[model samples]
Target: MTSPPPDAFANPQKLRRGLSRIWHATGYSLQGLRAGWGETAFRQEALAAIVLVPLAVYVGRDWVQIALLAGSVVLVMIVELLNTAIEAAIDRIGPERHELSGRAKDMGSAAVLLALLLAVGIWTAAIVQRFAA
Candidate 1:
């Protein structure tokens, strides 16, 4: 594969090496989770995930099915986090309205909606297969 552009390689954050990089990255990821908890929508999805992940284990008959079920639940939370990130970035840009900012936020919201729908479909199918068969 082609190497990243020189400018990309020049990122100052990339200077960290080895275990220091991994430890710092883990801390940063935790910080992001804390930030995500501050968003109401993300908090709600996280709470739902707490319940649904275990349900997925119960509902699924095999490892593949379990992974698909659990992954779908996590996917909704992932989308919600991304949507929250987009909104936070736009908000940080300033409170003033702009067409592009509005559109970006709208698209992010749409992504979360789609992820939720997909999760619902997957879970519903799994449930039906488990009980309705």
Candidate 2:
């Protein structure tokens, strides 16, 4: 008989704790980012983040504003990563079309859209606050 599939939740990573776990986790996170870099949407957002984060300093009037501005940009990238992850997982399941798969992909896309809108609103407010009399 063929071997059964390994348990998903209880794997070797669970045994790690403290600094050792963090060190490995950080490496895994970087690897994920490298994978994310391959996606066009993620690459574009990263490029935008490169410009917007520095621009946040100029547009923000105070520390709070700067933090909000920078945080908003980061939020977009985070959401994009999550959306890409969702799409990747769905695609991995199979090439065949399924209702749930379409719904999940759509929801993931909607999440990215919402994040972008939020970032835009925050940046717009910050810009107006900095420039308006």
Candidate 3:
């Protein structure tokens, strides 16, 4: 029987090339977000923060509070990106229906939900404090 191609397994050079491709893909993803004007729900939350940022500054809130609010917005985006990755990975593994794939996607969604809750909590506290004062 004939042997398969030697390049079937990745060598160091191939691994390096793969890593480079991954880097470029990450850059593309950023560009996509920018091009889309961050229209995703996660991006909308970021936009909301952008709008509130100036207001927060005008109100002269403490640095800690501002940091918390900004951090929460970032957290939502990060979690969403991770969720997208998880869903993509699952799909790549197998496009067919499977319990594990469903569970993985569901878990990723749950993580995003938790991040959203955190963002809401921060926004509510900051807005209430700014208005109350």
Candidate 4:
């Protein structure tokens, strides 16, 4: 009997040490970011982040506060990227509409929404505490 093909997933472990792995990983991350940028919703969120992240540093009083503010915004971006990835994978499964696919997409969207809500809540609390209280 013929041996099965090597697992594509196993290739990461085969990667050599030093600058090459870092270079390849960085390239893959950039590619993912580019793919995410192609989606309109991701583009809008990224644009918002470009503004909000800088504003976070200014608004926050201390390192902890700044971290909270900036981290929340970053969390939103991370969730958005993950959601986009999930949607893309679902789309790759097939063009036909299926309940599971719809559910998966909807769930991914909900995750993004929840992340946004968390970020908003954190920002609001921090702003009010710093200024109002």
Candidate 5:
């Protein structure tokens, strides 16, 4: 049997230390954000977040309401990011189409859909509570 190829994460000791680790982690996160931003869906969701997050604050009467509204938006972004990562990993595995790969991607997409629906429901409930009541 053959061994796996070497990569940056091969050695645990090579990891950064202290503040350097934090700095590198932050850079990596920014890189991920940039990569996600390049995706059309992520860009659209991000734009929605930019609008909705502040609107949450404006529409919510209390801190709890504001947190619920804003948290739902963040949850969607988190789910989308995870979904993107899943698709990227599946793509990196191979170009050949496989049933499992398609299923994995579909499941990831479903997760994003659920998250988005939850966000919409949360926002609608909050809005109705604040205005319709």
Candidate 6:
């Protein structure tokens, strides 16, 4: 028996189908987070944000500062979601101790750290300016 031609794998239609498959898989991620972390620290932090949002509105006094605060919160959540995706993908590849897998997870974690730092800086500046005024 002869193997299939390599060009078949490289076809543009096939690549498009693969991208669609990945897009559909994102629903699984949303479900996982809703059933897992959404019930724990994620829920608590989200609740805290909800509570603080009104107070921020009352005290924000400027549109730019409000946008900065909102954008910073969103950035943290976006980084966290991407980090979770990386960790999940690595585990799905293999539940074993491999150097590459560790590195991938660590790199994802580093991205989250940077996002957190950005959020801290934005919040600190906004709050200081708001209170000092």
- Candidate 2 positional error at 72, Å: 0.7
| lDDT, candidate 2, 1-133, per-residue tens | 6443465356878666799989999999999999999999999999999999999999998999999999998998999999999999999999999999999999999999999999999999888878886
Question: Residue 8 error for model 4, in Å?
Answer: 5.9
How big is the positional error of residue 41 in model 4, measured in Å on the Cα after superposition? 1.3
Query: For residues 32-86, could you state the per-residue lDDT of candidate 6 as single tens digits?
Result: 7675465354565566567656656655668877777777776767677777778
- Whose TM-score is higher: candidate 3's or candidate 4's? 4
- List the global CA lDDT of all models: 0.90, 0.91, 0.75, 0.88, 0.90, 0.72
Compose the digit string of candidate 5's lDDT tens values, residues 9-124. 67653455699878888998999999999999999989998999999999999999999999999899989999999999999999999999999999999999999899889988
Q: Best-fitting candidate, measured by TM-score?
A: 2
Kindly list the per-residue Cα lDDT of model 1 for residues 51-121, writing each as its tens digit: 99998889999999999999998998889889988998999999999999999999999999999999999
The TM-score values for the models, in the order shown, are 0.90, 0.90, 0.67, 0.86, 0.89, 0.68
What clash pairs does model 5 have?
none
Q: Which digits, one per residue and each the tens of the lDDT, describe model 3 over residues 64-125? A: 88777777777887787778778868988987999989999999999999998987887887
* Model 3 clash number: 0
Deviation from truth (RMSD, Å), model 2:
5.1
- Clash number by candidate, in order: 0, 0, 0, 0, 0, 0
Cα-based RMSD of the predictions, in order?
3.3, 5.1, 6.5, 4.0, 5.1, 6.1
Show the lowest summed lDDT stretch of 10 residues, model 4.
Answer: 8-17
Give stretches of model 2 more than 4 Å off.
1-10
How far in Å is the alpha carbon of 51 misplaced in model 4? 1.3
Q: Where is model 5 more than 4 Å wrong at Cα?
A: 1-9, 12-14
